[model samples]
Target: MIISRISRFISNFDNLLALFAGACAVLAVLFVLFLPLPYSEDQLYPKEIDESSPLYPYERGGTPFERADIHVQYPENSPFAGYVTAYLTPFSLALSRLTPHAGTTIVAHPGGILDEILYNTRGLDTVVETTILFIAFAIGSYLFRKGS
Candidate 1:
């Protein structure tokens, strides 16, 4: 009886949070649609990503997705699967160039970026994110269980 009451409280809280989120979404849409705001205009017509920005070398004729100056030589039998995988997910190559060459070590490095992403982030950000996901999944499973 106590367990059932506790579950009911938690389930009610979860439902309230969901409804609050939905209401916020609707409010945001209505606000954007009805109100006249300066910054919101940018959302409607975004500034064209400045091609001539020194970060991305500008070319008169260049591939839409690719930069001009930075030449990417595709490696044979790379960590990536093949040509299609490499093209679809160019992150491997991009990370190589973008990542800092030095000052990355904290005395003892644990493997690669995967470990860093899994472990290191802004303090409790990962913990909070994981908690939220876990709660959501638990609530969803409880609500969508086989019999009831």
Candidate 2:
């Protein structure tokens, strides 16, 4: 009877883990569709391009500045959100490279944070990767339950 109770508890714990993965997958998808990651960018050609400005090089007709399209930021009030975005960063970066103009690029340049979260989410690549991982984890969980 003790062995049976222990096995049952383990099974329930496994189920909970699967549920958590599923929830995370759904959250990632929803974030891609609705959650707005923040970003800040200046116009390429401002009326007055200062010597210290990034566009200064381009203003002189020198080699074009090489940089990502966008730089994203997390809310200062919430560190968890930042971690999630960081986790998605790898997949988003790879996708950005595969499609240069896909509009999900992130740069490390320093920029002021805006009080808006109405921009684009990380990227669909993050959703795809998370979903795939969730599916694989669910399948593995099922197999483990079946085997035991």
Candidate 3:
């Protein structure tokens, strides 16, 4: 029966090792999902710009209304900047709507070092998943080797 086969597999040392490996894979996934990234908003968006920057038109001999009208364009640094903006904008909007009083500004910035960091962090979700898969494979390999 299937139960007998499973029981035999579980009783084997190699199978136990494989099971432990599989458990590690599962744990890694859970950790990544629940893990708080060791980064903060301030750290991610460093004090690169100041009130004195030309981008802040108020500092450049402009009226408050004129400054408000001045729109700083996204610098042409990377091709994917647009895509990242497109994706995060709506997500930020939804977050803002969900928490009306949260007071989170969700503006998209074009490519810079910060942009790259954001992209990498956003993309790291896949890396976390892949790492789990690799761990599982490694454990499985060890178990198979022991069995052999």
Superposition-based RMSD of candidate 3 using all C-alpha atoms, in angstroms: 15.0
In model 1, pairs of residues that clash are none
Clash count (model 3, backbone only): 0
lDDT of 2 by residue, 1-148 (tens): 9999767866887677877888999999998998686654554222333455333321222211232222334434432222222232455445435654433233221111111112123345566778899999999999999967
Q: What is the lDDT of residue 51 in candidate 3?
A: 49
lDDT of 3: 0.48
Which one wins by lDDT: 2 or 3? 3
- lDDT (tens digit, per residue) of candidate 3 on 6-83: 999999988898899999999999999998877644432233333443232112222221211111233344334333
TM-score preference between candidates 1 and 2, better one? 1
Ranking 1 against 2 by lDDT, winner: 2
Ranking by lDDT: 3, 2, 1
Q: Please report the candidate that would top TM-score against the real structure.
A: 1
For model 2, the stretches where C-alpha displacement exceeds 4 angstroms are: 1-122
Order the candidates by TM-score, highest first — what do you get? 1, 3, 2
Candidate 2's TM-score reads 0.22
- Residue clash pairs of candidate 3: none
Per-model TM-score versus the true fold? 0.25, 0.22, 0.24
